[model samples]
Target: MLFFLLLTIIICVLVMFYIKWVKVRSYWAERGVPFDPPNPFLGSLTFLMRKNPSLWMRDIYERHRSRYVGVWLFWRPALVVNTPELARNILVRDSGNFRNKFMTASTSDPIGSLNLLLTKDPAWTGIRKRVSLAFTSSKLKSVQAVAAAKSLDLVTRIHEEGVAEISLRTMFSDYTTDVFSAASLELDSNTTLTGEGAVRDITKEIMEFSLPRGLAWCAIFFWPDMAELFRVNFLPKKSTDFLRRILRAKFKAKSVELNKDPKTVLEILMQMMRKSQDQEKAYSEDCIMAQAAALLVGGYETTSSALTYITYLLAHSPRQQEKLYQELLVAEEKHGHHNMEGVIADCQYIDCVIKEALRMFPPMAWLDRVALHDYKVDDSLTIEAGTPVYVNGVGMQVDPEFYPDPYTFDPERFTAESIPYTYMPFGDGPRICIGKRYAMITLKNAIAAIILNFEVLPCPNSPKPAEAEIQKKGLFLMPGEDLKVKFISRK
Candidate 1:
């Protein structure tokens, strides 16, 4: 009798699972949405561990050629917006209904959960308002000074460490770390020169891609429930602990000095904390530390990856590189070599080059958001509340309909008037990246310094920019391989 009962229970469980699977598989079909068939176990995420998300998004966009494509995040239905019109609607036109992102870190990890990037709703609004104060025009002008000094350091470093042996990504990371540390933390860093420092070590760890770290990031991005259940942290514990220790010490020593004049990013946060009547409620120590940590992670990686790609592309495209060099020469004649702000303000060709590079290799390729209510996607489909939506930014950038010769590296493409709602390397709407201006300045200064000092050439046996391997492990679109280029001194 016991054996018969156990067999009956197993049969019933299997029947229930089959019924649920049928419903899950037929969801997009029933709605008349275009979609690829999902894998039963991993849903539409069979590519998670094997492929890069940006490449996956591009594939989906090309496969459908529709306004949107339906996908599954482990049995949960989601939408990928392909067209710029729909992207605008989701990201900007109806942004109020999509203020919060679907991506989240585990609540158990305060440093990860409480940042401006990951935090949601009322908290995000308040934090964003406060953080905006740190990045005003005057504040960025001060940051430009730091970037200028560091660009000089970068040229010196490249001259000291032969370009043939230097890894572009690692070298750029070192340069970005030093610039971010000096500008945001008011701490001097020699990483750009020596490729070693406490801050540089922390940034290096944050960029490291281990299987566990990659899995943690995947969970945090695509499966928030799993992230919470598994207690995966967005940042490594040791990195956060180091940041806290350094932050606390700095805060303790500089509290009085910053009260008089808060200049740096951290100091600006401290000033906000000082003025807040409800200290714990408004800007708790954890919240303050979280922003600092976010600055480090967001600041270093995006700029470095962008620099790596820009340098690599310039190396391979000699004609375009000459065009840029000629433009830089004109700017140098007008503003002189040391005037970074003047060059950045006036050099149109460099801006085009940067835009083209970002279009080709966006660091964060997709924009994620969740619908607040039953959202009307179109006349045919009204997605249910709590549906995850991803705007395929990089996909649209590379689409032939939008950009002619999309595979080719052409700065002249951006010289023409661009289609509306198409390009967003820094994202769109109110929730766009806060550090956009700072990043642009940093890139401008570094590019000018390098182009003025060295003629970047492709190394022997190195892959072309188009053929470079995209990082399969990390969420961001970074180089999987060590991209190298030979820098011949222009002088």
Candidate 2:
């Protein structure tokens, strides 16, 4: 009698699960939407651990070729926006309905949860407004010296390390780390020269990926509930603690002279916090440190990865590389070698090459947002509040309809007027990357220095740019293998 009762309970539970699965599997089909048949357990996210999300998104775009595609993140239904018009609407035109990002972190991880990348409004608004002050034209101009110096250091490092022996990502990361540390934190980090420093160590940790770290990021991004339940942290605690210690030291030293003009990015943020305190709407130390950490992570990783891709892409496309070199030569002759102003204002081909590379390999390839209320996606469907939406930035960037021969590394495509909202490597709207100008300045300076000093060539036995391995574990669109290129001295 006992065995029969146990068997009956098991059978009933299985029936309930089967009924639930049927409804879940038919969600998009019921809504008259285009979708791939979801796996019984993983839904549309079977690609999570097996494939890079960016490549997966591109594949989905190619497969459906629809304005929107229905997908499920595990059992939860979500939408992926493919068209530029809808991307523009959700990201900018009607952004109020999608203010917060779908990605989130646990409250236990304040450093992760409070950063500009994950924080929700009205805190997001406050933090963004204050942080905007640090990236203004005049402020970026102040860091020109730092970028110029680091570019020269990069050239020296290449000469010393021998380009064939160097890992493009690591070499560029060192350069970017030095530039950001010196310009933002007022720290004289010599990682670009020695490949080691306290800050550099921190950045290296942040860049290092493992199974656990990958899972944590996956949870934070695709399964926020799991992130909260399991207490996943976006940043390692040791790194954050070290940053806090250094930050406190700097703040104490700076506080001693309150009237001094703010110089570094940290100083600007410190000033903002001081004013907030004066107004009795004080920002906490954790909040300030979170922004500092965000800038550090954003500053080094995105720019370095972009620099890596740009260099590798140029290595394979000699004709385009020559075009860029000529452009840089003209700018150098016109404004001298160290004038970043000339590179920023006059180097058109260089700009085009950078844009093309970013189009092919955007570090943060997807824009994630959640609906605050019932939202009409189109005349055909209305998604309820709390539904997650992903604007596939890379998907549209690679769409052949938008960009002819999207796989080819042609810089000329950008010389023509691009379709509106079709290319947003830095993202779109009010929450777009605040460091875009700073990043451009850094890229322009470094690329000019390298091109003017050395000619990059494709190393033998290496994979082509398009065939390069993408990181399967990382959340960002980064290289999975070492990308090496031969550099011959132009001097």
Candidate 3:
């Protein structure tokens, strides 16, 4: 009996190895897609966890230009689209055919994940109508209060933190979290400039795994089956429990508020739910948590990385820094004082600065989708239904075709005459980011306020770092080392 059992185990091992090896390789080669051969176990993402303090995704996307390159995420074949037109096709034009994104909540959060970024078809369209209306230029103009309050705290925090060597990453993170939480919840979260964490564990867990695009994000996408087999959580398990409790609590707490009057966004959502009968309606809890989670992840990371890069860029190029300061000063003088909307609207130079930074270091290194039905991009290649497709956004951002000199830091590339589909920092099409306006408000306001209040000085720790040395890690392009700056408050 023992001998037979041993023989059976050995046979099982051999078969498993055979199946895993053949499954990944044959899938892509059969499709005729250009692919890198996979490691039998680790697949194509062998260098996933290694700290590449070197290049960002621009290297990955450029290396595979002109074709959809195949990579393996542990036995799963993934395709990354390398060009701008093809990428625009993925994020826009044919977005409906490619609706469901990897790593988004699957039928679990229902209304919560039903926002345009995660959900699909009629459901995404419905909720997007309600939320997208809230982000229009007019609506964003109305929410200036949210930006002003958050900026006040940010400037004050810099004042209190006393201009020491601070990780602008952490500071900007707190500022954005405060703004997003207060706006989404409509409660005075009392987030102090020097204050510790304001909301609690729910948001903390939300951050850990929400938008991780490297190995962590891919882990949630391809290896969910393995996670299920091991009974392990890929996305933060901590967030799941906390989200349920906080959402339930908020729903319970809103009984009186809902009965009294409906003034806020949460109240508006509940009112919408009460009126709609046909579709999957977002409840108070669902609406609150969804917006909060979206803001918590997207709001902080996008704006923070943008701000971090801006500072790094400015610190290295003193001539550029002074030129911007003069521009801001002239704009402020014309406006009679500094206000975010006025400053952002009136100053074309500052717009250039922000746009240039976004061009070089986009927050999202890559974006993806899954085809719901078999589709053909051209006569030669036809991807079947459920095949994963992606655009390496970082590639498009750095492509010299769009921007004459992609590497040079000049903000004038976003002129009114600029062509469409060239830049996609907040994505595009029907599934573009709902909070794009809010992110702009956060980044622009923070930049304007920081420049107006303090002159960022180079750190004494080292000689001036090169423009390239200030580069980053993670799915979002960021500063690799702490881009330290001294805050000399202009009196």
Each candidate's number of clashing pairs is 0, 0, 0
Q: Report the lDDT tens digits of candidate 3 across residue range 338-456.
A: 46677656767677787788877776757768888888866777877876776777677777777788877776566655556667777777667777777877777778777778788
Q: Which ten residues in a row have the lowest lDDT in candidate 1?
A: 255-264
Off by over 4 Å in 2: 1-8, 256-263, 275-281
lDDT of each: 0.89, 0.88, 0.64
Task: Please provide, for model 1 over 97-186, each residue's C-alpha lDDT reduced to its tens digit, 9 standing for 90 to 100.
Answer: 999999999999888799988999989998898788778998888889999999999999889876665699988999999998889987
Predicted model with the maximum lDDT = 1
Ranking by TM-score: 1, 2, 3
Question: Cα deviation of 56 in candidate 3 (Å)?
Answer: 6.5
lDDT of 2: 0.88
Backbone clash total for model 2 is: 0
Better of 1 and 2 by lDDT: 1
Measure candidate 2: CA RMSD: 1.8
Residue 464 in model 1: lDDT: 80
Ranking of all candidate structures by their lDDT, best first = 1, 2, 3
Q: Candidate 3: which stretches are off by over 4 Å?
A: 51-56, 106-116, 190-192, 200-217, 224-264, 272-288, 416-419, 461-475
